[model samples]
Target chain A: MSRVLSIVTGANRGFGSSICQEFVKFSPNKEQHLDFILFARSADSLKNTKESIKTLSKVANVIEEYGVEMSDIPQVEKTFKDCLDKIEWNKYSKICLVNNHGTLYNLDKIDTFTDFQHIQKNNDINITSFVTISSLFLRKVKALPNFKDLEVTMVNITSLAAIKPFESWGLYCSSKAFREMFSNVIAEENKSSPNFKVLNYSPGPLDTDMQKEVRETCSSEETRQFYLELKKNNNLVAPGDSARALAKLVFTYEFTTGQHIDYYDIKEK
Target chain B: MSRVLSIVTGANRGFGSSICQEFVKFSPNKEQHLDFILFARSADSLKNTKESIKTLSKVANVIEEYGVEMSDIPQVEKTFKDCLDKIEWNKYSKICLVNNHGTLYNLDKIDTFTDFQHIQKNNDINITSFVTISSLFLRKVKALPNFKDLEVTMVNITSLAAIKPFESWGLYCSSKAFREMFSNVIAEENKSSPNFKVLNYSPGPLDTDMQKEVRETCSSEETRQFYLELKKNNNLVAPGDSARALAKLVFTYEFTTGQHIDYYDIKEK
Candidate 1:
């Protein structure tokens, strides 16, 4: 049985976990099953998640997971390399790597927040690690004997914070913006590659932990009320919707790669 | 007599030190007298530079100096506070801050060069610390009742890298871009304030140690030839020219506040 390799970061919960679930459901060819590589910080939290996935999982291929903090700078190469060691390279012809992990730091008053620890944490996961992991695996994919047929996709989860000045979303927004520009260059440089697909995805107004913190800290009463109303209207998107959108993007990877793919755009598509 | 107060960051060498020299040379009553404050990482460097200034330095006003590393996040705040602690607040009405520091990281393969020690160094001084210091000082100016007549101008020294993507200058370019955007917001938010001025300035391509390193690093014959041609053709700018250009921008600070003022744009003015 040939293996289809898929790696999802921040896969313990939220959109990352949701992405993995859809990969199991919509992934083509059960006979050429995908070996799911779930990367996250918490293994215990995933124990409960595994039970739910067991019920919904449609693909017969086995799930191989990595319990490591992608944000931890020193461990990234070692951890990701270990997973690659286990994979049977010949079995996989396509690699879909989704980087859904993100860290949002609260820093409206620069003087009040000069904590390097917080800055280091945000920079590591949100910007540097994405580049590091993508570059590492990209070289590997290119070196593979199945390189000609392989579609090496790198999808980065990004935000609207780049365009709008969201209060206290400094670290998060800057990181997202960097990712967008980074992916743009990658796409341009690899224009001729038939199977090389790199995408920057804006997940769009999710009712997630990061958003919850934003609502609490924002100084503007009007902005806070607007978000609260937005959530109440169920105007906020669900992780499942993003997951489905991503799955669709991958299946139609030919059309969506290289540009920034927003969840809002998927609705129109 | 009121003291003329100013602070210059990255004053250890090059345009940073030259900027400090220009400030000291601006004759009291030429516009207004200023008691200057100099900031850099080396106390010894400032001491030697101080000798040249003592002759023309304001007779009655004092020039206080400090050593502070911008990378130490908390240390910037402490350094600024230490400066503030020494100054008799009642003596000075006008505040001028110059963010004139930049750094380059190891240039190598874009995909493989994952070591970010140099990137972080640049961010600490050029981007993060600049914002932190400016944000704090702006609020202070707003908070003080005596500062009603005070005009506080923050000048961020940006580079060509802010707009262009030079292969070897990834981290430096990204940080400058970040600084430009940061100052843009500060300007927009302070649109109503006549006294608060946030400015971004590119000093042009000067023959600083940084530039010299860039020239030396292009050891390849093809690339070195291109740079040699650029320099010979009068394309390269000198440090003195950049310093003089910035002085004019500061002289016309009231007119150009909250906007980009490039040394390259000297002709139009």
Candidate 2:
């Protein structure tokens, strides 16, 4: 039989693909088992990713669902609904959902490239879709009888960008900050649900294309200098390193489900 | 000249009407300097309100912009922008904008209501439009070279319902909470503005029709009980009293902006 499925969005490259690799390492084979229902907007990206990770585990059922952006609520809702229909809730004791996909919105030059549409898109994809999808997920799990005993862990992979907003990243920062509060409310809502854990994490800076893109896009001389300074101080962590650390937290961290787990918080705990 | 052209949305009843009355108390002059525009969606409601508020000393600009709903962003954006355009910002020292009109999303059973569009609508009006309009106001004042010296005050008439969300009030409560944070961010942005003060206030339960309507809806047992407790304890302040308290804050409490001002906070300060 197929191993219990784990779904990861934006798994073409960067943080998302790293998360999938780590999930493979910690597939919860002790009680039951786990596989991956990989999700990304680009099938070509997913295809390349599938090839790279193919040798990792032949038994690992990498069910790929590409071309779904988290911001597009209708597509996400339908895709996940189909995935739910296909999956066996009884086989999996827990559905560890990693919301790692995010669209970066940087208004470098207010006059040049500052289209507020980017902000709206960021709000839709990064924040609103996460919430809408989560609501759908809750409805799905609530429908299952055996899964009634299991808690659903929702790990929102947020960034330092949420709080420490830069000048150009106005929209992206605001949406992420708002999303943090939204998730906090969600956690509060699930207080009665013992099996529900919603974790908002600030994974330390990773050497990714997103980071480089942001660096290139930022217009403020002071802010650009600050980024350089931060980088020179060796502040950025590798995605793979961060992934392993996150994997450890997911597997070993025996805390309640609905806490905002930042890197400092996790280390402190 | 009109006593600082003041615009209040949803002014037909509840907190909006009360806001109109209270604004007059702290005008530049009792006779001539007062322009209070009352806006609502319904023609009947607007006319009835116009008749009630019409007086010699204080001129009420009864605008038939139709009833503005917080949930509909496009309608709100257009209506609010149109209403804003007619007013000359130079005539008024302080354009006191009190967004007191709001509607709670509730139902006997949620499925009867359809989708989260209503919830989306509530946020659009109460949160998104509130912020958007405030931004427009800031831009308006900033555009004029002379108005730069004058003070502008924004008081968002919020409810205790937002602080502690109840069943059936998911959208209303969360939207208010979200708006507060959004307000804070905006406040931080406008800190450098020579004359700007923003405050989010929970006008202790007013004896408005909305309160009675809330009581009548009676969907969630918990919210019903809470309302009863407030009414029993005389915690519910009359709209006039609430409005007076808010007006005083707008004029005299310009020092205290960017904070979530509660009824108790006013008393304490």
Candidate 3:
């Protein structure tokens, strides 16, 4: 039987957890065994996700849970390396890495960003750790035996802010752009590897805590009103709905490598 | 008599120094008294640029030189704040900030990037320090008396890498994208201020130490050959020529705010 190992970051709540649950619903084949490794700020935080996965799939097992502080660069490196080392590479024919963890620094004009420490912390979490983990993951997996036969998929959870600048979202927009471009570079570097794929997925403005933060703290009154109206009009996307689209893209693998695919861009059959 | 205060980073050598020399050549009018503040790793490093500016325009003066380590976030904040506090805001009717300081991190494939410390350092220099200095400059200048009457221009020394991904150029490309998006947000935030403008300028391939680094350290043989061919065929741009075009863009002020103008995009008459 071919086995699959999936690793997800920020897999404790909202969209991250939803991706875990939704991915299982799409993969019910008795011939394939599924294993999961979840990462969040604390293993305890992933309890609900672990329970939900158990309810969703009897064939899927939550094999590991890592409590990680993404801003701690050294710790992040060690943790990711340890996870890869512990994995039995020959046990799985397919592997997927979801780089989904991120932080919204603040909702303020760029000129008003006065806290240097806060800015550094944000970059460490959003940019530095993302690069470190992704680089490490790719290096370790490619070194495995039968690498050419094993399927590898890398997904970057991106946003509309990655392409368009939003007022009072200076840090968030720039970090998303950085991730999307980095993913593009990865796709370019691995173009000859037919078994390798990269996807930049924008989950849309989901009804989550992040949206609530945006509505409350956005410096521009107009932007704040826009978010509030989206919520009021029921225009915000559900986490499960967006996650299903992302899973469909991952499983179908129809995208041109390095393309930015939005939740709204997906066509349901 | 109106005065212009222009602060430039990476002003010790290469394209940074060339900008200082070329900007002086463009502002030969005696009616516009020009004062400069140059930043590099050491104040002594800026001696050549200072002398070159003096030879170009008798009306231009090197007002200050700051020795800065861009990777040190706390020190960057302090140095930029000190520079702003020492400036006589009432003495200048126009202000310009050129965020030109940057480093070309090693050209290696994304998966082969193993040095976490190096990655953090790259982010600190390219993204964190740029944000710190630009924020301080904008906040300090906008708080001055008669601020609306003062013309302000902010220039980001960007590259084609800002929009395109190249194999083995992952970090460099992502950082440039981050800066470009951040510049776009600044434009969005300040759209109401008719006197405020931002420019993201791509200088093209220049005959500088950075291109030499690319020719030496690029991991991909194909990419290395591309740069090598540019140098061999005498196709590399001269720093003075590109800097002159940038000076024209800044002085003529014909571009839309936050527009990315490349060296080749300019029409010379």
| CA shift of A105, model 1, Å | 0.8
**Ten-residue segment with the worst summed lDDT in candidate 3 chain A?**
A25-34
State the lDDT of candidate 2 residue by residue for B123-196, as single tens digits. 45555556556656666666676766676777777766555634555456555655565555556556667477
| Residue A75 Cα positional deviation in candidate 2, in Å, after optimal superposition | 3.3
TM-score of chain B of 1: 0.87
Clashes of each: 2, 15, 0
Q: What is the TM-score (0 to 1) of chain A in model 2? A: 0.87
Report the alpha-carbon TM-score of model 3 versus the true structure: 0.98
Q: How far does residue B26 in candidate 1 sit from its true spot (Å)? A: 6.3
Ranking by lDDT: 3, 1, 2
Off by over 4 Å in 3: A28-31, A267-269, B267-269
Candidate 3, A110-172: lDDT as tens digits: 889889889998999999999999999999988887899888899999999999999999999
lDDT of prediction 1: 0.68
Specify the highest-lDDT model's number. 3
TM-score for each candidate, following the candidate numbering? 0.85, 0.84, 0.98
Q: What C-alpha lDDT values do all the predictions have? A: 0.68, 0.64, 0.92
Which candidate, 1 or 3, would have the higher DockQ against the true structure?
3
Candidate 3, residues B1-269, lDDT tens digits: the string is 87888999999999999999888888746558889999999999999999998887778999999999999999999999999999988888778899999998879998898888888988999999999998998898778887998889999999999999998999999999999999999999999998899999999999999898999899999999999999999999999999999888777777889999999888364
